[model samples]
Target: MEQREGYKRELYKHWNKGLDAGDGCDTRREVIISEAIKAPVVTAGCKLTGGSWLSPYDGVTVSDAGKLDVDHMVPLAEVHDSGGYAWDAGRREAYANDQGSPSTLIAVTAKSNRSKSDKDPAQWLPPAADYRCTYAAEWTGTKLRWELAADEAERQALLALAGECPTTTVVYGTAP
Candidate 1:
């Protein structure tokens, strides 16, 4: 595979461009509002004064939206490594802001998202034991949906994780 050479974070335009653009809230805040355990008050200009969300990554219930990070199931850097480097800016932006699948973009604790940054399944898995299976499934599904290629190590790790969750279903769409 040809390397992308220099992968810049700016290559993928995220947040502020997803669903309900007219709602005054950006993709990050919008995800927070939608995933809130307790609906938050959306004041003018999409300022989320109060709300709570469950970080499935660690089962941590966060009451403040500021502490949450809207994570991509597959990080942008990781996507570049997984063949997204070949995508045009438009497709890359669409992938970054994809809310079509709930798992595509999610709200998790900043700590968890940061810790999981740019790592593939082979390098890291969710810390929450119970969430590992689901994580693997979602990770796999996201790759499949985007027609992203996983390295051998990642494929092996996913296979092992899948064995643990035989009943877990991974529903993905065709190649884009």
Candidate 2:
């Protein structure tokens, strides 16, 4: 557990790069995706964090990682489309590595994450009726933290979905 914690910390450091959480403006997908998969097994032996088998997407309980995916809060394509391409490999890697952080990553149902693959909120959403609010806030928080941009449609979609989870204390923060 100690070793795992150490690795998570290192990974977080690599991702953060001393930049404030919301400073990754104009990120490119080419750079981040390459780095995103480098730490592919961060939660190998660990249980999923935030929301669970009771999927916020489908409302079904997923008991295993096979049923889930560590989704990038800001999809890679969106990152690229926004401007990630101009970043150095290290920053890209760090953005991809954002998984180790609390606000940019989520262990969500395979169906939900896949359904949302590289898509902005305007393009996809969780099927679970109760999870939309948390989902929206997370989506907003992730984009804001990374300084990722959203088109008018995407921004509206997020605002609408956030109406579902009205609580403001969803615990968006750094990873342990």
Candidate 3:
């Protein structure tokens, strides 16, 4: 209750910081993926209720947990390299486990997740072209929330991917 809220508030205060005083710059995809698979948060529907597994990567539906991976929209490695080396472990863990936030912790296919392993937008992309716009918004939103900076190549790639989808003003909520 209050204790949880307090911790959340504290973490949010230093939300921009990540593991190992920012040295935890690598996406740590293996560790993150392994942990997420152990305890997955259900996906939400358009209205926010728990919905069936819908992978934005390939626009496929899968009910089997083994088939999914909880993707970090703004990859851990990218953040670590960008500035995560300065953050505390708690902040990094929260960012790693962020799920209540919209489009932050998506359940995508294992193949897609593996394909996206530790790479920024410049290195990987969704197979479903239509989702690129939403994906960019989600990625940008996470980075903005964590006060993270994107590499020049990643920025360019995101922009290019976003261009193919319908335009919408991107907005991110306060840190939880």
Q: Is candidate 1 or candidate 2 better by lDDT?
A: 1
TM-score of each: 0.95, 0.60, 0.67
lDDT of 2 by residue, 97-131 (tens): 56445557555567777787777778877777666
Residue 116's lDDT within candidate 2 is 79
Which candidate has the highest lDDT of all? 1
Tens-digit per-residue lDDT, 40-95, candidate 1: 99998888878789999999999988899999998998899888999999889888
- From the highest TM-score down, the ranking of the candidates is 1, 3, 2
What TM-score number comes out for model 1? Answer: 0.95
Better of 1 and 2 by TM-score: 1
* Candidate 2 accuracy as lDDT: 0.54
Cα error, candidate 2, residue 156 (Å)? 2.1
Report model 2's TM-score to 2 decimal places. 0.60
Question: How accurate locally is residue 169 in candidate 3, as Cα lDDT from 0 to 100?
Answer: 55
Stretches > 4 Å off in candidate 2: 1-54, 162-176
